[model samples]
Target chain A: MAQDSAEAANQRRTTARRELIETQIHEHAARLFAQRGFAGTSLGDIAESVGITRQALYYYVKSKDEILAKLVADLTSSVVTRTREIRADTTLGHAERLRRIAYLTVMDRARDRTRFQLLDRSASALPPELADAFLEGRRLALAELRGVIEDGITAGEFRPLDARVGALSVLGMCNWVAWWYEPGPDHPAEPIAEQMSDCAVAMLRSEPTGTDPLAALATARASLDQLERQLRIDNRRG
Target chain B: MAQDSAEAANQRRTTARRELIETQIHEHAARLFAQRGFAGTSLGDIAESVGITRQALYYYVKSKDEILAKLVADLTSSVVTRTREIRADTTLGHAERLRRIAYLTVMDRARDRTRFQLLDRSASALPPELADAFLEGRRLALAELRGVIEDGITAGEFRPLDARVGALSVLGMCNWVAWWYEPGPDHPAEPIAEQMSDCAVAMLRSEPTGTDPLAALATARASLDQLERQLRIDNRRG
Candidate 1:
């Protein structure tokens, strides 16, 4: 039993070391690909950046294409999974859910701006299977967002508009952050995420027709009371 | 005099021919670059697509970068010029102007979807000077759009919000068309442009509070009139 436990501990340490090297490979590859166009980058450059031989790099990733595919898959799957969770949350109102989804997406893109930009600029250079997988992930995310918007419209929390267009508009607003957001003292992620999510919600809000019906009724009742008092005084004066 | 006229006509024909070939080169280059990424394409490929030898193609463009720079310059200048014109249009209300600008942008992206997509996917591959020029044009366009939103707020036609965020949101909605818009019989451009523009306008509209003041006053007066009649009857009975 003692020998078996020691072997298990040794195995765990080896696994952790491998995982760390793989992560380093991914990071170096992403930086190189973002600096040079994907087509311009090579496995050798990534290996050199990560302080490994080209042969050693292959132990972590099969090819440059594999690195790109893994990076995109990681990015897309996380986003799609979170979006699905947001869509499935029944406790939240549709408007609030939509706002959270928008916030989540903007922050996701902002946090991974470099990877997102690299993907945006190099998607066509990806292998066909990898490209298809990335696109499928995007479609799935869009469907989840569309489902949320449709629910909002059905619940009358959102204005009646094409849910697909609404989804795309919200996605666009969030995704464009990847292109323009630069992390700095003046432009932090949370505030920009908040503002963008608010804008997305604003775009979908149903125009209030003469205010809420209850509020309108209350105002009307108050005016009637005041007018009645004035009329009573006038009648007495007469 | 006859010889001089003939020589002038010959010169004009030569110039026209040169312009035609240059246009063909650009179109073929855009298609190839869009299909294969910028870094993946070559001058020889563009020359072959245009039915010219690489040596002959060099007469028109000094390098592949020049071709890309020209295409981007053409696209950006036209958009910047149109945006500036819309911004300066004093007769139109701010809301209308903003709607028109949004419509124009979406339609512009739709019309040149191929080139726009190419630019999006290959911007980082552009030479530094060309990239700077493109970025400058983009900034100019954003500034013009933001100015319109700011004017709308000042004129009380739009709600007070961050004009920069509003402008980017509208731009994101329109620019994203380049990514997803596929022209077909079922999906027409004009209607999509119209809907997006309306959504942009809706996003900026000041929420109506109990309807317009004139309408609210009219309602109150009508209520007062009815109350006065009812009171008269009550007073007589009493």
Candidate 2:
């Protein structure tokens, strides 16, 4: 009976090891895929970069698509969990609570930099259904931000602006942390979060600004709209 | 001789036709690639989506990489040029000038939804050299912002936080327009720019802050020490 119990324990250990390996494969693939893009990279290249054989990689993930799917899935899952956690934390004020959630996003993304890179970099190739699901994770986060802004505005803590756009403006700064927040050179996340909290809160408190951008936009629009209106123009000069 | 001039004119027309086709491919491909992703898409798929045969697609651009390359090149070129022009404008106050520049960035990204998506979705896959060059455009734009913040601090128009970090927070929000700034329901480009400008300026104007996250850092250190001691004792118990 003791021997049988030991055998069962060993089998469990083996299964756990397999799962760890699979997890690493996905992480490695995601890192490579994000850096090089999908078409620009190959399976052998991903395996080689991970210091594993092509066959060993196969033991973990069946193919590149599976790796891509897993990368985005993992990100969406974490975002959903974090979003819910912040939404449910009733003890904190809306501003403080929103700040905490935003900080969590940056910290979480930092720990899983490769996956963030993949989700940001390689997510363009995902099919429509998958893309929508991934984007909805973003939408949920945006909705929570909107809720916090609405709470603050209604409470008179925040100046009244269009809450949806305002929320996006605040959230966008935090989300873009994945793009530029390198751990080595930038000030630590704690202080940076403090700064962001100030900025977001400031955004909440301020009035509207005025600046027009039509001249610059006209350049691109001229080209884009010309195509739209090409056949309708008088092409002949008599 | 008039017919010869007409023939030369015909050559100019043909060249413009080719440029338009190139522009067409860039537009369609950037939109599709940003939505789909590089790996999840195919040359055949892009051609089909463009309403052209694979052969016709080849005549316009050699490969998908060429398409990606063009999008990045085009976007960075325009971004850099506009940023330079904004920086060069001499008559405005540093803060107002910064606001106009920020307005340029927010509006520019808002106009080309595809390039905006590409900034979020495609930059990761760029080869290291190209990616750095592409990013440098943004970095230059940001340098312009940093100058404004530093000048504001010098002129007593802003608070005395780390100017660089403050600038990063501002640019982070501005860069995010691509993901969130849709045109119908909430706020359009002009209003959105104003709201963002308020946040950016307010972030600079607000006095130090109330939460004082530096206090949290010390508390974190104490809690970490406690956890370490508890973990050591638990391991000895086993």
Candidate 3:
């Protein structure tokens, strides 16, 4: 009876320990991946950073690529889930849903910028299976954008342009922020999110009635200036 | 006199051989770098691909970074030279200059995509000195766009948007094409260029005549559909 109890306790401990190791590995891998890139970093380096033997790492996870797959998998799944949910909301006009998605995407990235950064850069290093998974996730997201474009057209709220290119333009504008974005010290996420959403929405509107391009552009310029200044000023002083 | 003639001939042959080796190194490096990123690719692999010893490759170029830098330097110089010559014309509006630059960028990419591809991916690998050099070249080209935008705003030809952000928007819409653009089998360059120029002009028009939101939305949807079908059916088939 005592042996049976001990075995149960041991199994529970192993599962808990495995989970802890995974969480730590993920955290360290993200930091390292962003610092040196996926290809530049090795399994051994990750193991060292995690304070474990290489053999111990192998016991917990199969390879570095698996760790990357896990890191990005949540993001991909979230995007698709959000896109599908947004698309199914038939009551909202296409433009309205698209605007919501845009606003939400900016906010999402604002909350967790590191995930976006890793997903963008490490996409090339994904093996075939994970690559397909990632690509499917991307295609679903892009398709959602196109659906919004189509809905907007059917609803008569936007101009006619190639949906794919328009989608690309909107996404290109958004995804680039991962590389250059910084939250304004003076303002918070709300204002930045509004401006980014407005930029996407304004670009969609066939008419520029009362549009304010300078507002967002000024904000973007100031934010970029802060980033460049930080590199020179903060890096040395800190 | 005969000895002097032989010396000049031999000098020309040596120069020709050096140029040939340099070209070979760049070609191999670009292919390898694209397949396995800049950080992932090593000098040994590059030399092996070129069928030369590591010492011989070094004799031609000082280091791997040198190969990356030269690729961008040549392209950067070309872009600046082209932009400066156009800016000197002094007879075009912001729209026309934008058209010219967009077309030139596209045409240049089409003619020698390999060089520009290297520049696009490897610019971040540059050392501080090389980074400064390459950035100055980018800034020079961007400044030409800035000039056109500033002039447009001053002359009341464009709405009062921040010229810098607007400049990037227009350039971003154009340069991002390098990421996914393929000269489609059905649509050749000239017609597509003309249409793209029209799109850019339409984007910047200072005035907007209010149209029904619903109709505008429908038009946008149609365009997006066309674009989706237009994107290469297989982005990874290559």
State each model's CA lDDT, in order. 0.82, 0.69, 0.68
Ranking by DockQ: 2, 1, 3
Off by over 4 Å in 2: A1-23, A36-48, A52-70, A127-129, A185-187, A206-238, B1-91, B119-135, B184-187, B208-238
* Ordering by TM-score: 1, 2, 3
List, residue by residue over A21-125, the lDDT tens digit for candidate 1.
Answer: 998898788888888868888999999999999999888789887788789898788779988898889999898999999998888888778888777656667
| Steric clashes per prediction | 0, 4, 21
lDDT of 2 by residue, A126-220 (tens): 66666777888777767877887887788666788888888787777777777677766334566566657656765676332212233223323
Candidate 3 lDDT, A178-212, residue by residue in tens: 54457677536665456556556666655332234
Clashing pairs in 1: none
lDDT of 3 by residue, B6-125 (tens): 999999999999999999999899788877777888999999999999989889988888888787777788888887776667688766776687667656655555656556556666
TM-score for each predicted model, relative to the true structure: 0.74, 0.64, 0.63
lDDT winner between candidates 1 and 2: 1
- After superposition, candidate 3 runs with Cα above 4 Å error: A1-28, A39-67, A88-91, A106-114, A154-156, A184-196, A202-238, B1-28, B36-67, B84-90, B106-117, B182-199, B209-238
DockQ of candidate 1 compared with the true complex: 0.16
lDDT tens digits by residue: candidate 1, B50-163: 999999998999988888988999878888898888888998989889989999888988877888877765665777888788878889989989999999999888988888
Q: Of the candidates shown, which would achieve the greatest TM-score relative to the real structure? A: 1
